[model samples]
Target: MPEVVQNVSKEGVKYIILGCGRTGYNVAEELAKETEDLIIVDKDEKRVEDLRDQKYNALVRDFSNPGFMDGLPVPEVAFILANDREANLAALKTIKSRYPATYVIARAIDAVSVDLLQQEGADVVLYPQEVVARTAIYHIRKLHSSRLALRLYDLLASWEGTLCIVTHLNPDPDSISSAMALSLIARHASHNKLNCRIVYEGDIGHQENRAFINLLDIKMERLTPQMLEECGYIALVDSSGPGVNNNLPKSTRVNIIIDHHKNNTQPPSAVADFIDIRPGVGATASIMTQYLMELDIPVSKTVATALLYGIRADTRDFKRNVTPQDLNYAAFLLPLTDADLLDKITSPSVSLETIEIIGNAIRNRKINSGYLFSNVGYIRNRDALPQAADMLIHLEGVNTALVYGITDQNIIISARNKDIRLHLGNVMAEAFGSIGEAGGHATMAAAMIPLSYFSMAKDKEGLLTLIIDPILKRFSEIVGLDGEGEE
Candidate 1:
């Protein structure tokens, strides 16, 4: 391992350990490196003086003061382990104030203190006791539940690590961002190749979302029959079932599924990989955040910002449907996120093309039987479909709004509704089946179709209308709003 390690051999790593008690000593022992990187500090002079006298790097002083941290040669990376919460936090604060550039990972006593440490500039926080307890309980439950037991077995099942097809349900910021982030993870493994493809049948619908898609360069390539046949490993991200938002190609035998939606039912295979589906959490991105923490992977600033944005956009910033996991992930990502990048992603300037789409939505809009409908065209940014749907829903007499558009090679639709009981995913699956695909939550929906659906979409309005109305009629029938014999 030492021979293979291609670390920068420029300078020796300097460690500033705050306590020499059990945990701190354990840390030092773990770091008993051949690189001669050793620095241990303890308050008891008599106990540590002998080591200092023998030429071992040791400091015998009560480093209780935040100022005491300045005297030590803090490494570019420092691991601080003080037993007491207040003392640990103080040492962390002092380390950051002095060595502002250090990558600090601190030992924490509880979950809440981790947040404080992060706020004080600690890059990572670990509560050993709490983690051990959670691990024990999770595994215990897994052992008892045969279903969970098999899935755990599957994650490591050396299917030479096949592709994990993850779906983003209701495909929000967090769901989509998490799917992309997980793709990066699956790609890093030696034998496994993870190809992340985004599939959305409805509109993103929000201006900020439209901006995020443009800035992040997120593209959804529709799945094909050949691609499905070739894939062996499968993972679901946000959405879960066939009858729901996904018509998962029957070949996609799901191995793992990480989600936070309400449970409909568990997936079927005995050898399934993992179902880290936590219903209590607000955002799936939060669940992915916890997984990253468990793997001890360092999230880049962009990843941090993206996860943070996902959580904020989904949970409305810890205000709604936020579980412990949601809060934990938000707390985890907040300090790591780049404030400027997040701001830029959240408030990107609208383009003239976007404005034109909005104009067309209004100019050709219609309202009937509580449904506001419109046919749009030639638009590039897929973000506007849902936004147009949402805007149309705001019309005085509208109960449902379905906005349709035709790009050169695709038929795009964003559906919005004030009806609280309808399942938009089911509605889309039934409506768009003949032409294309649609998937999203009840209040919001989106779909994508092949070029064949839009024969002369380039022709001003004639061709676009022919393609959109039939789909809308299908949707109306599915929702039981279509009159007489419509289909």
Candidate 2:
């Protein structure tokens, strides 16, 4: 064993690099800027000499040999960077046996070696190939996003009039934030040449959703036919097409569609010039964040917070239908988001009507097999249906929950499902598509039937009572339930 040549004092040595390979040398160079209490050792005499020439404390030693580090001071950290798997594992076991307290970071040639290295007491295992592949993938995604951003900019710049960015009716955090992001993108892409307005058709009925908009001060207007007519171009956010979840007329022409919903009815390309619908993504806001990053646009604190909340809400805090892309976008926005504002947005005061609706849903609940159904009577707050359904799904023995309420113009429905065999979106569409609009994701879904469909009834309560049984029966049948349990 060759002794470590002391270029700098080895007193209070805290770090050691066991190889002078490419990764080890690069790490040593970086750590050199932070501390001089580090040494680099390699079996190759020429590599050691080269490191010493650069003023690094270099030594020629066989790290895989037992007792190689016996005379050296116990380092707080040791990096074993040999490419040979057997040598690296041997080095790792030897170091951990002597200095059990030392944090050993070992390099592995592959995943199998990684596990072996860790079992031998490597505190961390670095697979350089995996690291490089991940870095490359991240950059490639950014490059692709930049190309898409440029294409979107070119499309926006091609048109010269006002751009109406539409969100789905009763816009939640995801749709609202997505629309806001698209508006920002439109402003940047057109260089302020396009007048952009965030437009929607339904009320921001959820209390938390209201707080999100009020806290962020997001500007959105109710969509009117005149606004659509005035705009030279139109874009849909969190909505795939006209007359789908939105109140847009079927004849309306859309220029751009950005959504994360899985829609088989109308491909966005058929309805829009620029379409970015990725059903695999948890939120449309994630797609918007990608655009912001690739375009190098400055994200405001408000926008950052909204986009973060949007991702959380759509993904249910990364628990539902989440993908790697959503997480990546969220990580990018986390540092820029305002933590206090997010807390306030997510913890808004609950409304009395919402509580009452939830109470009604619980009181009127009916169970058949594992399916739970509830009618919340008549509701002025349409957003409460989903909240009620979300709560009902948690009941014991229930894998699916459906809540419906009668509004003045529509019979609103909201559903939540955890049964792996069930597809709630398709079930809702099949159950209600003939009389109304309905669709959503697998774990969640919704429907809306015009009250006019049941106008034959004399009164609201009578109408609700008469139609509830049939609707529940139809839904139960669609889900393939065998028997109707006594309620």
Q: Highest lDDT: give the candidate number.
A: 2
Once fitted onto the true fold, the runs of candidate 1 whose alpha carbons sit more than 4 angstroms away are 1-176, 179-236, 239-249, 252-256, 260-272, 278-280, 314-324, 408-410, 419-439, 447-460, 474-487
Per-candidate Cα RMSD to the true structure, in Å, reads 13.0, 4.1
lDDT of 2 by residue, 411-438 (tens): 8899999998988998999999887888
Q: Which clashing pairs does model 2 show?
A: none
10 residues in a row with least lDDT, candidate 1? 1-10
**Model 2: ten consecutive residues of lowest lDDT:** 4-13
- Give stretches of model 2 more than 4 Å off: 1-15, 32-39, 44-59, 72-78, 82-141, 419-423, 439-442, 456-458, 478-487
lDDT of candidates 1 onward, in order = 0.68, 0.86
lDDT of 1 by residue, 1-487 (tens): 0111122243434655667778877777667655446677677776466645554566665666766654455476677776788878877877787778877888898888978987887898878988899999988864554444233434433445346454553357886778766765555432344454555545565568766776666775455556556666666677654334565654456766776777454353323446676677898788777656655557877777778889888877777677776777788888998897778887777767777888888888877677777887667676777667767789888777878887666777888877777777668867885667666666777778777744644583566666566657787777767544311
Clashes of each: 11, 0
lDDT score of model 1? 0.68
